[model samples]
Target: MSAFLRSCRRIFWALAAFSGMSNLLMLTGSFFMLQVYDRVLPGRSIPTLIALMALATVLYLFQGGLDLVRSRISGRVGRYLDEKLSIRVFDALVRMPLKTRADGDGLQPLRDLDQVRGFLSGGGPTALFDLPWMPIYLGVCFLFHFWIGVTALVGAVVLVGITMLTETRTRGPARASSRLAVSRSALAIEGRRNAEVLQAMGMRRQAALRWREVNVKYLAANERASDVANGLGGISKVFRSILQSLVLAVGAVLVINQESTAGIIIAGSILTARALAPVELAIANWKGFVAARQSGQRLDQLLKILPCEEERLALPAPGETLVVEHLYVGAPNAERPTLSEVSFALRRGQAVGIIGPSGSGKSTLARALVGVWPSVRGRIRLDNAALEHWASDALGRHIGYLPQDVELFEGSIAANIARFDVHATAAAVLEASRAAGAHDLILSLPDAYSTKIGEGGMTLSAGQRQRIGLARAFYGKPFLVVLDEPSSNLDSEGEEALTQAILNVRCRGGIVVVVAHRPKALEGVDHVLVLGDGRVQSFGKREEVLNRVLRNPVPLKVVAEGPGGGR
Candidate 1:
């Protein structure tokens, strides 16, 4: 975050310089009023008045030009901050869920970044830059006359107090509203994701009720924040006008005392208004300023908590073996390890099927094998290197995974089969599809491989998505393939294709790890691992482990009734 901030440091300095010039030019109006009232009007010099008007017009034009430049630069600075921080923020968004159970919405960081960027780019920064010039305005007022200067000073103090009051009153409500907004967003996202379930199970009304409950709270908080900031802002505006009129009244009194001229009345009023403009602007924008501050602080903290991965030396791709030693795995933020004291090894051309009763950690081991779940106490190594040693993208290229849900992204069949790689080749896509036994099925579609699957591949049937997901796992002939419940949605034909896909991976000397409850999914595997109560019950050649696990007579639903299903 600091590095990104430094990237825009020079721009901020430049903006400040522009702001200084622009604020100084603002006095052109006040000076014009003084000359018009005292010199031109009193002397009855028509030519002098025309010349004065021309010079004032030129100065005002310059001031307007300066203002336009400052605004343009301010907007650019906001965009610059976004350009610098977007990648890091996105990386955090992706990794946060896997690392922790917090960040319920998983999008607050993005919202925060947007808030900060919007505020930085808007007119808010302009008020901030012009704020420091208030003193200069006050100093000029003092030069006008003692009484006039005193009146402006008192008004300035009162406006500052109002700004402070706005800040104090709005802080809690602003923060509350931000939190409620996240909750509302999270609810909306989850509701949409499960829209089918809600509709099918007659939960639509209940879901709507739940949403309304959250939205009402958010609206209340938001309304409270707006009421405070806007109410105080209106007060500030009315008070500023009053102070301007009062300055005129004071200047008039001084004129009767022969201490100042009539010109001082108008000049003093103009100076007072100019001096307090920033405070009025600040009051109006206080809510956004607080929100931006809070969001920026959260974004900074998120980046620090989940720092970017450092570059690691590139290691040669592993094709030798996979080893897990004393592995203990758990769900994200779980209190206890789901798979404890679990260890296994597999070599090239080997296919191992993991079978277990429900809650026995078979899926947990599968996730750990694919580097999705962090091990609590153990190491998973590919060849001689720890799994964590390889960069994530590089590691992903060599490893393929299909989880239980079969989440196929939105794209064409060929794109999903190639894992959406921009450089994916036609031959590779065809080969992976053929290897997964999905090539023929794909050809049957109206557009074949070019068919677009709607979001989450909802247009495809469950079995179709599963087959495509398998093809994706086979893309690039990755060295390690792990599938959880690969045949859960498959018919007999799909099951046969899944078995053959496993065989194909083994034939290519790639290691395959299958987590299955169905007996048919283990038909193509060379070895079997049996787990119970998160502990390894037996693991060895298929017949041996199956015979041993069957001896328990537990009637495990996770594996075949007989040894390797009587193979």
Candidate 2:
């Protein structure tokens, strides 16, 4: 993380230089007043006054320019931060373990990044930079009179104590509020995503009530933090006001004793105020500082977990060969494996059907095969190379997968079918659609391949969505294809199209694995792998395993065509 920040060191250095110049010029007002009272008024010299005013005008203009330049530099620093971390955060989110992903909102890291960026560009950090110059103002005050310097120094100490008190009282509540905000956001997003199911089941009120519970907690935490910060800020403001007036009183007393000039009294007050301004601003913006600090810590942790990029040798594109060696996989956070000690080897031009009851690990096997879920034991290799050994983007090009829960992005149908690749040609997309038997169906739509779909393709029927997903899996002519419950929503015509699609894949010498609960969908499969209770029950030629399972009466249910051709 420090290395990443060092990339923007040049801009930080520029900001520091500008801030120093600006702080130095900040004494112009006090100096101008000092010259007027001590020299021009006492000497009755209009010429001197005019010349002094002209010099002050140029200094003030230069001060304003430095201030503007620093602000622009700060903005550039914020952009640099986002540019460095956004892609890494996105990659971390994508590669996070499934259990971790489910336990918290994935979007929180992005929000944290935004918070950090906003703080760097805001006044909070600028106040911090100006804070180190407070002593410069206080030391100048000492030049006027010892009593005035003593008073200003005491006030600075008191304000610093108050700022510390504010942080001490508000830190816990601020952190609590940030955490609750993230959780509340996650619940609201989940509620929105599943709104249809809740509405149909008449559970919208219950869901809303549950979400309100978390929201109330979030609000209460925020209110507590705000009350503490505001209370401390008000106290700091009152102290600062009283301190400024006290400086004037002290200077007046010294002037009455004929020890200091009238110019000293006014200049002392202005310098005292300048010394305390940064401290007061810091107190007021303490909450934002705390939040940004917490966000930085979280982002640092996320960066630690993200895999580092290495210069890997580009391996050759894999053929239709998959080997699973004593593979074992479990669901995220599950104690027992979902698929245990399952091993199989598949070659080119072969179609395998995985049959089992619901929760029988068929879908789990499919996920493992496609590298969507990691195995707890053993390895999955393609063309003699372990799955993890291949670069992710390079390996992805050789695989196609259609999960049981079909989800589509909001875009034109052709874009989704082409995997949203900007370089994909229309001819390639149409060919994939044709292979999935969806080209004619797409043409029947009002806008054909140009039809716009909603989030998750909610505008299409379930069968239509499934067929489009199948077309997506068929895109790019991948070496291996895994489809889970592909026929669950398909009608007879759609099933026929699916069968033809599987045959076409085999003809092209690609490997196809289908996880199906319906026996009819397994027609023409060369091999069968039956699973039960996270263990492989049988694995052999399709007809041989089907015959043995049908001949023997086992606890594992076998769904095949019965003697009279009835399921």
Candidate 3:
């Protein structure tokens, strides 16, 4: 957080400099009034009055210019903050723990960043900058007379106390309201994403009831915060008004005693008002201040947990040799490991088939191999380098993954195949599509590769989506491919294409690991791994593993009858 703050320190310094000048020049009006009452009016000197008025105009113009410069500097600071933190926040979201991502609104950090930016660019930060100059105005009051200075000082202290009180009263409710607001946003997003399922199953009413419960909580919290802040703002306003009047009353007493002139009375009142103005503004905008504070804290915590990438020597791009040693992995925060002591090795041109019962950790192994999920113990290495040693983006280019749940983004079929890489060439996308056997299907569309798909490929059929996902996995001729149920949604023709795709990858010396439920899907694989209850039951040559499973029928029930056929 300090590092981020330092990035915008120069802008903040400029803002402070301009704010100081603006405040200094703000005394122009008070001094002009003092001169008119003390000297110009008494002497009835027209020339002197005209000269003072002209000087006042010049000072006012400069003051206004300084205010404008300060405002622009603050705005620039806000934009700089956004530019510096937006990408980091997004990267943090991507690298966040799976459990955390599942349990909360992943997009809240983005909203938090926006809140911080808005506060900095808006009047909230300006009020804060002006707050330090309150005593400067109070000091000027002291120069006028002791009693006038004491009155202004006391008023400033009271307003500061009120501002503190407002913060104390509203802090908890404001934080709670912010959390509930994020919850409501997450629920809304989830509802939209799963709208089809809810509507088809007549669960929309239930979803609405759930949403209403959360909305009610948010409303209660928000109202509590608003009530406290508004009550405090009103009190601060009334107190400021009374304090300004009190300054004049005290100054009048000084005049009666011949201790000060009438000019000092009006000037003292104005200076007192100026001194308390920042405090009043701070109280009025306390909500925004609280929100920005919370946002900064959240962003700081998030950045801490999601560490930035350290500079490391670039490891060579992985070849076909992939090894997993004594690997243990679990769903994030789960009590039990999903895959225990899982170990395997694959070399160039080898295609391994993983057949397992449901919940037996085949998909988990695939995720671990592709670096989507962190392992609980041991390591996965590619060409003698631990997976973590390689930079994620660099390693990702040489690896391909296809999870059981096929999903596609909003784009043309070719873009999806190219992994939406803006720099991907048309030839490369075409080649990958042809390898996945999706080329013919894509060409059948009206616009071919230029056809725009809906979000999550809503416009495409299940088979089409799966095929496109396979093409994504096969993109760039990656050295290692992990496909979990890649053919689950494919028809017979699509299945044939998938089989051919696997064979093509092997022929190209790429290592392929396919998690399959059907026996035919495992055909042509060089090695076979059978898992039962998260442990490897059989791992050997394709023929040997298949023969052993067949001879022992009981253990092979998972592979023979499919994933869900056995416990």
Candidate 4:
């Protein structure tokens, strides 16, 4: 609220100044017109006539200048607020809990914010807060004659009421239309994202039909809302015309009775329009306010969500081992736990391979180890201390993770490799690349390490992308290295390279836990854990786990080779 107020202050002050100057100037002009009619024309001095003309011209010029300044400053203030709000919202999103982000519906905040830009740019009510003369003009009318002022004010209110009534009748349809439009927009985005797949499946026509259905639904609602709004606009126009006619009639009568000067009557007529302008606009843009209100509530809800300390990123610690004790974790409002009664410890320099079928909770365990699942009902410790005790930055430095689906930024190869450490020398990157078996491939490219990878490394083959991901894990010599499905999308050579990279991390006295499906990749690991249905089926030395697997042929084919070289 403080921020919002501060953002509005400049515009408010500018509006106040503009309103005051315009009113004073207009009043001065009214007095001048009266002097010209009642004094100048009746054999007044030439000097007096010149003086009145000069003063009126100066007042009009000053009014124009004040209005110009107000408009410019108000626009600048609105833009500044737009930038500030966008930055704050983005920062909040980055800090939001993973679960909350995933469960939330859409990117409507961004869209609504865009609409807010239009509203602000339209210089709506926010820009009129300082216009005190609007009321003062009416007060002047009342001072001249109470009944006249009362009639005008009442007419203004009734005009506004009629406009608002019409708007209200269509509000529901307007909101429904907005929702339908957003839905169609989301579908369009989804279709564009999967255009390749849709083409492959020959479903483009079907997709187009679905898109047409959504479009028709959205258009129908929009047309209904538009029709109702136009009707309300017509009503508002009639009321305004009636109000203006009454003001003119009253002003003419006053002029004839000599109760008010002709100049004052004319000024009063203009004031009538000025006074009702904001009311008319306020009624017309009630929907903008409604939308803003809804958007604010959503942002407030997101801000109000409690932080989950466990999943939050923490600083690295100079710890040797990571441990979990009977950890239990599940999504909010879920009846069954994703993982429960799971206990494990990773020692310094240990290599542990976790094997499981799809949906066996192996990936969840990996995520838990990285502190992404903070609501788990158990303890995770680093060097015998609570995981939360460590700072997020420090913790990240001590751990390197390669998710099953690789994520790469759109940048040159060197840029991605040096992301965590900007000062990483070429030699260090080359060494890491070699370990991951990507150095030769990178060198084969026209630009070598300087080669620009497309967004998410889309330009690279799947296997090459996986190698780059693996190479990033080796870039930093973290205490713990976690690789989930490192070889799932890799070919024979890529798998060989990934296995060697794992060996390299292990050789450096770093703990490695890899979720693997291939037998060759698990070779020579210090320990093996077989998981099924969120429970540990077996956990022991590599040889022991292999013996059990041999008894009952492993679910994933495990081709073995005596402790030797390549696959």
Candidate 5:
């Protein structure tokens, strides 16, 4: 939250103003009592008493007005702060290394992010709010009465100690619970995400079991923590009751001796309880505070990641090349590299087709080329310099990457393709869509490109969605276009359409790289890089690689040209 400290000034002052109003209001109540006792009872005059009561009511109204103003200012500023924080978090995730972004087994790190964010959002603010109250409460108490203030001060210490102890004991359990909950949440999300797959495979029962396992563990940990908190609650009540009884008893004895007035006793008791309120809240939310702190720490860690030099480059001004040399990437705690000693180069107007079977690291290689996998060894040069030397903003402008799964937003097709970049004009959008073979399909829709696509493009056919994905890739006419299985689910007609779009990119003098298992889709490509066992098996002209593979009986198939392209 240190990152947010600068903005805290606005929020803090707003809260300070509100807190001051609250204290003033409380003091007003005591002052009204003081007036009633000193004047109203001594002189039983109705007009005088009514006038004084009216003045007290005005004071309360003023305090309430101040409180309303403070709340308005603080609430608005707090929302802005939250937006800033969320933006920073999203930018960090986008810039983080591919490995760091993923949990394990090559899933999107976004899944983990969503889980962590859910846990943090609900439980993160307690500590921050609690910290602010500490000084504010103490300052008010000290101003009220030093002797009572000292007692309040001691109570604060005791309250903090109890909270700390609860946090110390419950922190581990809370963390375990949050993690389990996240796991279950992820599974539940996955279950829904792949509901069709689960239904097809008749694995609904298995999915249910997996979900139950995680949730049961989560629920058990929650119960255990709840029991501990309940025990602490009982003990805290007994202790507080005893302390309050002693204070009241002492005040009564002092009153009997005429050392203190009934008014003083009442004010002192109320002050003590008010001072203790924050402490009680702190203890009650000890686990929540810890959870929030951990979340903030995690958030901070994520935000502090320094982007590599590649992510800092300016956009390519046309005529750029995408190059790689002796690239290698290994998984954490695994000796076997995912992409081993892989190397290739692609210049403007060049098309390089990368073919590999499942689990052969094609996706990893594609990500490395985009500078998303930064932990890999070896060189990745864009234009004439290291890819790492370019800023992400620059590289992003010049490189368009299309993953196997196209994640479309819940917006119009044109909006999704343009990513809501206000600069993208209608003509530009149409050009991109036509070039991607998505224009025909989009124009057939009632609203054309303006038609809304449901979440993840659920409303569009797989082929149509893939076309939209391709259109998104071409929206900026990026120098390098990386397509991972662009035609995986396309029919013959869709494949032909996709092939034409690829050729269109090549004709535009842009570098096109297709990561594919079905090499037949890469017909007429200039080059082919075949990967096996995480290493490059062949790197040369498509014909040369095919010849070598055929001679070695390595199962080669010639790419067949689509309609309109000569065979």
Candidate 6:
């Protein structure tokens, strides 16, 4: 990130140079007034008037051109910053929930990046650049007259003070607004996601009330910031006008005393106005500037904490063994580890079913196995290489994961089954689908392979989505397949297909770990790892572990096969 910022120095310098040229050309109007009133009009010189107009016109064009270029460059700078940081911000967003359980922080990083980019592309940067020239404009005023300079300096000071006040007054409110915005956004998203449940339970009104509470707070914060900024901006505008009038009044006295000419009066007034212009502009843009600054700080802190993934050597696909050494896994920032001291090993072509009761950390163990959660202390190795030794994308290609909640992207059935792989082959897609027993399901769909699944696969049934998710896991013939609750939503036929899928993976020299509560899901596994309260109670052949667990009085929730229980 620092390197990227350093690269932008050249662009900023270019903007600075453009601003300088633009401001220098700004003198054209005042100088033209002076030349007209003092030289052209006095001598009744049409040629001189024509020459002055021509020169002023040319200078004005140059000024416009420079300002235009600066504006364009400012927008490009924002784009460049977005290009540099957007993916990083998105990466952070995707990993955010894995770091904490605070829904209030949802999407804040992306919003921060937006705030920064928006400010840069807007009028805020121009105001910031022009602010430094306040002294120079005042100096030009002094060249006209000392009193005029003093008056301009006084106005600048007051406006600058207002800018400071604006900063302070809006800073806290702006930050609060941003945070509340995140809360509000999260609430809205959750409401949408659970809309069906809310409607079914007739809780829409209550949900709306909750959303109202969050929205009210967001609005209040925004109002406070906007009110202060608008009020200060109004004051600055009125004061700049009053300052222009007062400078004219002072000039009138000078004219009456024969201390200055008409041209000096007009030119001095123009100089003072130009001198104080930046302060007013700064006041006007102070809110966005403050928001941008806060956003930048947040981005810095977030990036520092979760910095980009370090480059890692790409290792060969694992087809030998999967090993876990005293693995301790838990939810991020949890009070205690959810799964502790879990050690296991599996060779290629082996399948293990993890049997445990509810809240036994079966899902947690599966997540850890697939690199969803970082182990607190332990190591997971593939083919004698630590998981971290391989790059995430590279490792993902060799690992198949079917999460408990099968959330599918908005795309066709084939796309979802193929894991959205752009280069996926038709044969590979069909092969995986057939392995998951979803080929017939796809054929029955309205568009078959071209059928759109919609977001989260909302258009499909729970069983169908789960089947597609299973197909995705089997895609590319990954070497390590981990399925959490693989049969939770499957019908008898689907379960049969799932069992076959497990067998298919095992036959292909891949290791499969199935997290299950039902006995039917364990039909294809040769081994079973029994967990109780996050600890391994027993690990051995399926029959031996089941017999041992059944002999114990307080066995983990392994139950009888019956209707509505286990398939």
- What are the RMSD figures for all models against the true structure? 2.7, 3.0, 2.0, 4.5, 5.4, 2.0
Which sequence of candidate numbers ranks them by lDDT, best first?
A: 1, 6, 3, 2, 4, 5
Specify the highest-lDDT model's number: 1
Q: How close is candidate 1 to the true structure, as a TM-score?
A: 0.96
Off by over 4 Å in 5: 10-25, 28-74, 95-97, 104-161, 223-246, 284-288, 306-316, 330-336, 444-447, 554-567
Name the candidate, 2 or 6, with the larger TM-score value: 6
- lDDT comparison, 3 vs 4, better candidate: 3
Q: What are the clash counts of all predictions, listed in order?
A: 0, 0, 0, 9, 11, 0
| Shift in Å, residue 267, candidate 1 | 1.1
lDDT per residue as tens, model 5, 1-567: 565756567666666656665655656665566566656777777887899789988988988887666656545554565666665665666555444534422222333344344433442333234355555556654554555456666766776677677876787777788677667777887888898999999999999998899889999988777766666756666666665655566567767887655655555566566556656655666655566566666666665663223334354465767778788876543456688787777877888888755566777777777766664588888776787677666667778888877788899999988867888798888888888777878989889988999877888888788888888988888888888887777777777877887888888888888876555568747898887778888889988986776676553333333211110
Cα lDDT tens digits for candidate 6, 451-496: 9988778999988999989999999999999998888888899989
lDDT accuracy of residue 398 in candidate 1:
95
lDDT of 1 by residue, 314-338 (tens): 9999998999899998999999898
Stretches of candidate 3 off by over 4 Å are 97-102, 551-567
Tens digits of per-residue lDDT, candidate 2, 1-567, equal 466667777777777788889999999999899989999999999999999999999999999999998888888788888888889888887777643544546777888889889988887778888899999999999988889989999999999999999989998998889889888988888888898899999999998898899999999999999999999899989998999899989988898999998898898899999999999999888888898888888888877866555656889988858898998998766787888899888898888988766677888888888887889999998899898887777878888898888899999999999999889998889989998989999999889999998887988998898889999999999989898888888878888888899989989989999887667678847888888888888888889988877776764555533211111
456, model 3: CA deviation in Å? 2.3
Specify the poorest-scoring 10-residue window by lDDT in model 4.
558-567
**Which lDDT tens digits does candidate 3 get at residues 1-567?**
568778767777878888888888889888888999999999999999999999999999999998888888778878988888899988988777653544556778888999999988888878998999999999999999988999999988888899999999999999999989988988888899899999999999999999999999999999999999999899888988988888888888889999999999988888888888989989988899999999999899989877788877888777759999999988877788999998889998899999866778888888889988888998999888988898888889999888887888888888888998999999998889898999999999889988888988888888888888888999999999998887777777877888899999999999999888877678758899988888888899998888888788564533434334211
Residue pairs with clashing backbones, model 6: none
Candidate 2: stretches off by over 4 Å? 97-99, 558-567
lDDT of all predictions, in order shown?
Answer: 0.88, 0.85, 0.86, 0.71, 0.69, 0.87
Cα shift from native, residue 509, model 4 (Å): 1.8
lDDT tens digits, residue span 1-567, model 4: 234656577666666667676656666654676577667767667888999899888888888887677666657655765786776566456555445533223566566656665665555543344234557667876775665687678877786577668667777877788788778887887787678899999989999999899899999988887777667766776787788778878877877887876655655666666666666666566666556555556555654563323444544455478787888866545577777788888777788888766667778787777766664588888788675676665677777787877878888887786554767888888877887888988888889988889876878887777778878877767777788877776778877877777778777878888877778678647798877777777878988887887686656324343211111
